[model samples]
Target: MDASASPAAAAPDPASTPGPGPVPPPAPVSRLRRLAVPVGAMAAAVAAFGYVAAVDPNEPGHYPVCPMLRFTGLLCPGCGGLRSAHAFAHGDLATALGSNALAVVGYVVLAVVWLLWTVRASRGRPLRIGVAPVYWWGIGAVLLVFSVVRNLPFGSALAP
Candidate 1:
């Protein structure tokens, strides 16, 4: 401590210290912008289903045969999916279910999933599908059973 060293002389100037000034608030996001992903997904689905409805899958040569059904004479889980979609698009629920019950169930599941996605997106939140392993196994089991049943003699009604 020197005799001439005063407390004010040792202090640094506050103006020289770097500090962050007032930060501007974040720009507000619009509702439509928040729902962009969901809207795009819905548009894509509508376009695909619209095309499937326009072109008849029941008519041979309109659409390619399922590779699994072509190679093996067995009905896969997605054997009559296009026919199901065609019937569904035409508002014929019975025919859609008859064409492919599993595909009809899938359509319902997809709709529910899409609704969930849209709702979350509208609320500015991301949709997170965190299915447990058990659920995945259950889905696999359903597909396996559907494929097997549609191919068996007792499951003639399930066949397309």
Candidate 2:
């Protein structure tokens, strides 16, 4: 011991000593914080779907008709998507496809992705959005083709 040291500091005191004792674990997250994002998304999706179902696209003047169809006498890729969703919600698969085959395909894809997202979230994993550039390009190309073909007289069936 050094002669200059304080008497209190000189003696090793077990009561005053600080060491790494057992550390308490972090508190678990609150339920609201954990579920907020997912619940909000689902609510929004459901609300949008419900709104589309309630508003009839087929009934002229209820919803604005597609201007592209009026001007060029063509069916745009998104022309009948609202009607398709309405039909789909009502379990009219054929009518849904007739309204917009692309939209039906999109709905199926959305359902699958949503299912996967929900499962992953429940398992405490982050949401995944993995799409290659090629896949994106392919989707774009398909939409372009649908738009062009539906406009042509030859693809009258594809027209809304």
Candidate 3:
């Protein structure tokens, strides 16, 4: 019990204290689990495309006309999307573009995004597509312009 040698001085150094070793890495994901969501999504899309390809949307009564076009006699953004999908599924690029160029572009965009999503999921890193509100608003504005332009005689080429 010397004045200079306190009880605290007898304690062991924290750095030297024994504890659990370094943590192990996370378990690898199962192959089936890795492919499940991407595969399922692709299968569903393929099924829908297949249906559209077989059904012939150009035939009257096969698919309902867009309500906006029906009520207002004005082409909406999605007026010819079904016909575009139908033509795209049949490998008719020109017909697809003629039906709705924007919808054809949308198909290409969806394919690219789905490819990236599948690749990331297979690698055990899921993709999170988070677009800002401003970008969404810009997309809406573009769609509005497209709709308005397609309805005008000057932009009749875009009409379905």
What are the RMSD figures for all models against the true structure?
Answer: 4.7, 6.1, 4.3
Candidate 2, residues 1-160: lDDT per residue as tens digits?
6775988667988866898877899897665666667877878988988887888777878788779878977678999888889898888999999888999999888878877776677666778799999999999999999999877888877766
Greater-lDDT candidate between 1 and 3: 3
Q: Estimate the TM-score for candidate 1.
A: 0.83
* TM-score of each model, paired residue for residue: 0.83, 0.75, 0.82
Query: How much is the lDDT of residue 88 in candidate 3?
Result: 94
RMSD of 2: 6.1
Rank by lDDT, highest first: 3, 1, 2
Considering summed lDDT, which 10 consecutive residues are worst modelled in model 3? 3-12
Candidate 1, 1-160: lDDT as tens digits = 8845988877878888778967899897888998888889889989989999999999999999988889999999998899999999999999999999989998898999999998988887889999999999999998999899889999978989
Task: For residues 44-75, write the lDDT of model 3, one tens digit per residue.
Answer: 99999999999998889888888888898999
Stretches > 4 Å off in candidate 2: 1-27, 30-32
- Could you tell me the lDDT of residue 100 within candidate 1? 94
Clashing pairs in 3: none
Q: Candidates sorted by TM-score, descending order?
A: 1, 3, 2
Error of 2 at 116 (Å): 1.0
